[model samples]
Target: MNQAVPAPTVSPLRPTDTRSTAPTRMPWLSLAILAAMGFILVAAETMPAGLLPVIAADLQTSEGVVGQFISVWALGTVVVTIPALALTRGFRRKPLILTAILGLIVANSVTAMSGDVVTALVSRFFAGAFTGVVWGMLAAYGRRISPPARGGLALSIVSIGAPAGFALGTPLGATLGTAFDWRWAFIGLTLLAIIVFALIAFVVSDAPGQAASARLPLRRVFLLPGVAIVLAVILVWMLAHNTIYTYIAPYLRATGTGIGPDLLLLVYGLASIGGIGITAVLIDRVPRGLLHGSVALFVIAGTVLLLAHSSAPAVIAAAAVWGLTFGGASAQLQSALTLAGREHSDVANSFLPVAFNLAIFAAGILGAVLLQSADGLVLPIVMIALGAVAFTLTIVGRRTAFLPRR
Candidate 1:
């Protein structure tokens, strides 16, 4: 049985009552800030992907070596997420959050100024840890402020930031690097981090709940009847999606698809954000049905890609559908996890980022291996197979302990 954790305790945001401690009754501003933080950090994480050549040139390293350095960011987050959260469990939420944002600022600034690869990798490692801590806390932070009945909606609102960051960040890094230098991209991250910091300082609640106080034992947390199944659903779904997504560019290039891959990516990103919009409207009203409908999009998209991978328009349409489903599905799963964990939502929430990042890493490696061994045709089939299986599991398990107790 899950033990209940108290909803967030409201604390004074400021030492003095000079300004509003939060966004005040509306909380929309605060929500936007959280969303922007998501966007900024995703962008920061992806900057290397966009500006690799420029970074390699300035640092006098091979592009291949620079590409390999992505491990510094990935590995850093993977290692630090749990430990950082565990160590900082007792701090005030708002300031710790800002400090996390500050950590990003320092990371990016150090990266921008690094004269050698060692300095840059160290900076990125710090950035990853900072971003990981924030991500670990993000869902709790979002849910804590939400009116219980509208928790899903609030989560969806904040969740929109990831796709938005990808949609904007991929291009922003290239634009800044091409116009000035790669360092400008890091500078951009720093600037955005500062702005997000200001928003957190001014708008987010001075909530007093330290993270670890309510966290349940990880093993026991998953031992709740439906939690593991739902996590399986999430893992397969994420792995399936990332498998195709990580390799879309190469697939398009090889196939000579009539559409521009970059354009399709932007569309995919926008559609993902659109999916979040769909969730915002429907999650609280018909939560289970909404999840079923969203998962079905994956099945449909996978089938389309399987049958018509060569049709540029079909591929494009499939990508949009993919984004829509993925964008919405993430928040929906978070909702489901919250319910599945019963009163121990904090423990459940912490599992999300860890699962998501692992899926990305594992699936990307697996997908790349497949691409090298087989062909583009095989990737979507794997996606379809995984998606179909996940759909079946979710549908069959809908009425199980996975859902919210009404």
Candidate 2:
């Protein structure tokens, strides 16, 4: 019998090796630092919304015109997310993240220095473009760095940063804008962005090499049946939520509510935090269908407030409920998208922000139009219709379970 040739010994470091030995666990300090970076980035992006009225007054423009700043920022993100993902595919994570942070730094700095509405809008557009890249990379990095079992939790932690930013940034921006000027808010954001840039640059590293075949396939992402339905849910939900949120200050003033803008921001922010916390607990335990059903209750509550706009307390309470449910729905929808495109999680994840921003743009335009139309009655009605759409889609989508069994 011919002697069998001894198999060549394979080096563990070989590119063909499929097994990942284990990623060296970073200290919690590093994780916290990364999370803080995420917080600052998101805060800078959203802080303008809270300061919109102040900016509008200073710039001598209508609130509706000021609202376009938000739409433009979101539109930038909507247009950039996918292309950014593709461009950065082969790039190292650390450098790309650093570049994004730097972009925020520049964007915020420019926004703070802007002398007119046009310059501010341009700065915001650039800020959102960078934000899109940061968000896409952050999600992809979160999944890569985490162990399989902890992936959802890791993403959740990352997701929480955005809402946390929203929660904190709004009140902070409003208070600062009230005390000083709107430009100061952007200045504060610029300083924060610089700090986050330094932290990320110093702490994080590139992810381990992935299998070449494991790269996200856009074709597969589009082919998933649940993608479009889930996108619709996200679009409608965001449109409804932002329709109210975008003009909340004006709405309160119109209703003759004594609650100041700062107070409203505080209430909305806190409610959002509560919602996020509750959803974090329920997402894994409760079925998606039921979780969405529960969120629908808050939408109804919001509708009730719109109808019964007489009581200040009731309206505030409804806003709180809306914040809670809206926050939870956002998280659930993101998780759903991730599950829907298990094979192309990054590509699917990219769509969430894209859909979210696009919806925001649509909502702002429509809300502005409604506000200009017959005595804002159309606003509430449109919100109710959006809530109905969300509820109906959740029910219809529930029948087809596309997500993998946990």
Candidate 3:
């Protein structure tokens, strides 16, 4: 029997801080704040998706056209993430994060007040660009502050905020949209952003030695074969998940399942939270290969939903499984990517979010086209195709000598 050797642990403090009487470090609070920032930024981005119909009615445009707003946001994020991460390589974390929060505030405010569809789309674009910066900075910050042995767990905690945002934001936005207007959803997000911004500004410190490195080695970071494989895995998974998620409520309604939008949103949000919670505990203990294998369960869940269209209980169970696997697999992939780019974790982390948003953009376009075709089976088929791609990638990744050994 081969016993697993744990990764070496680092104290979450500077070496020069040699005060023998110093209190034990508390990194978890800082991690929580970083996670909260992620949650708010993601919520701000995804809130619109749940309120798409309301926004379309308000703007007097078709829902299809309104959906383009999400695409625009993802496109903007992909375009900006690499450059932003590279350029800000040596900047202090506090200012980098603060600037992102400011941009988010402005973006949310603009989106909330938009009088027309074009303006709303532009606001979402700016929001995405700012969100990219935040995502990169937060990941770097999490790595810097965490005890080395627990890096995976720490990063997973911060990453969990994104799915948590999805879980909460969609339901919150739908509920608010139904009560007042979709604009209020943006307003609520703006307030959440403000709160997180203030908390982070007060609690989080500038990452040590960040300013010591003057230039980011972008070329070297991208040169790793594992980086590309990890990115491909992330992209395929997101594409698969979003193709079904973007229309989950609609699909539920179409199947004559009496589930309301509010209840569906609740299920998604709670299931995602459950997934993240489970992963937070299991990631450090589970073998990386087994963790990767578990993502296939999401594919299975999506297929089950497609096949059992007449069973409401089965559909709901599948939804929970889908949410759990999607959320868990995301954290696993991020951890794998960070390990693959250990020398340039920030840049590597930047790619994960960029790839994620780009996949969302692609999925939206492809899902929209599929929905227009009126083929009830197309979405699930696309999901299974994506799942197959993910599984193949996982197998190929396992064969690669570049990945960290179990």
Candidate 4:
């Protein structure tokens, strides 16, 4: 496939030397904090999902209208990701990262205080832009923060933020909203941002490419064969999944009810955590396998949700399937982008978040339309169609993927 070679176990930078003064375990600690940053940034973005209904009532808007928070945030990300990554090139890593984290604090605070639809849209739009850039930063950061050999593993760890953020954000927002108000959820996110900011200030170290010597054209970034394929799969995956996921609360409210909404999200988040853990371990060992299972899981989850409208157990089961698949899939796909883009990993990394959020933006629009038009049946139909494309891509991608020869 003529892509970047698969990552080795040791770093690609300096060859592993045991006599160095830096603690061997130090990178792990730094990467973990980076993972936490990934967690909170994502949490801030998806927090709107858990509190969707509450925000609607408080603003006197329909749930679909309130759902624009997710849509606009993603759109903002799509708009700013490339430009932000391009502009930030050649800047030092820690300060740029700290700035991105600081932006989150401000964005979450903006969303927290918004009471009108217009205000919410503007606030969420900026918040989403911050998320997109951070995600781009996170991709390149993951590879350089640790040894190059463990780059895939490093990215796997970074990917933990997606599902973990959802696992924590959805339930945390729901619980906070249930106890205090939806505003409290964003307030809590702001507080976490402060903590993460401190952690980044102290823990994360400088890396290579934090201040790159040169820049590449954006079009030349994803010129590789598998790069576009990975982007397509990510777009299809998120579009299919979020089509239903963004509406989980309302879907439950409409069809049947036995479990509390917060509790339901908690269960789903836990499953997402489980999925993240599994994928992290497998990403290095069996990445394509993990990707295939993840896309397939989406199809299964959508089907389950469609048929299980009457059963609480059925819905819970669907949530579990959805979470586990999404968690693993998100990380594995990021790894795929890194591998496929090869020498252009940084460019690939920057663009990956853009693709994800762009897909989210697309899905947000698709979901709102489906919710209004098809009453949310768009999930199953979209899943099957997207899954087929993803699965087909998986097959073609395997033949041309960045894997070493068998």
**Best model number under TM-score:** 2
Candidate 4 lDDT over 30-67, as tens digits, reads: 77888888888777777777777788989999878777
Higher-scoring candidate on TM-score, 2 or 3: 2
lDDT of 1 by residue, 299-379 (tens): 898888878877888888998898788777777787788778888767676777666666665665675577666766777
Estimate the overall C-alpha local distance difference test score of candidate 3: 0.74
Worst 10 residues of 4 by lDDT: 14-23
Candidate 2 TM-score versus the reference: 0.89
How many clashing residue pairs appear in each of the predictions shown?
0, 0, 1, 4
What is candidate 3's lDDT per residue for 180-266, written digit by digit as tens?
998888888888888888888788755652443434577778677678888888898888877766665556666677866667667
What would the C-alpha RMSD of candidate 4 be, to one decimal place? 8.1
TM-score of 3: 0.87
Candidate 4 regions exceeding 4 Å error are 1-25, 208-214, 402-406
Candidates sorted by TM-score, descending order?
Answer: 2, 4, 3, 1
Of candidates 4 and 1, the better by TM-score: 4
Which segments of candidate 2 are over 4 A away from where they belong? 1-21, 24-27, 208-211, 401-406
Clashing pairs in 1: none
Candidate 4: residue 5 Cα off by (Å): 46
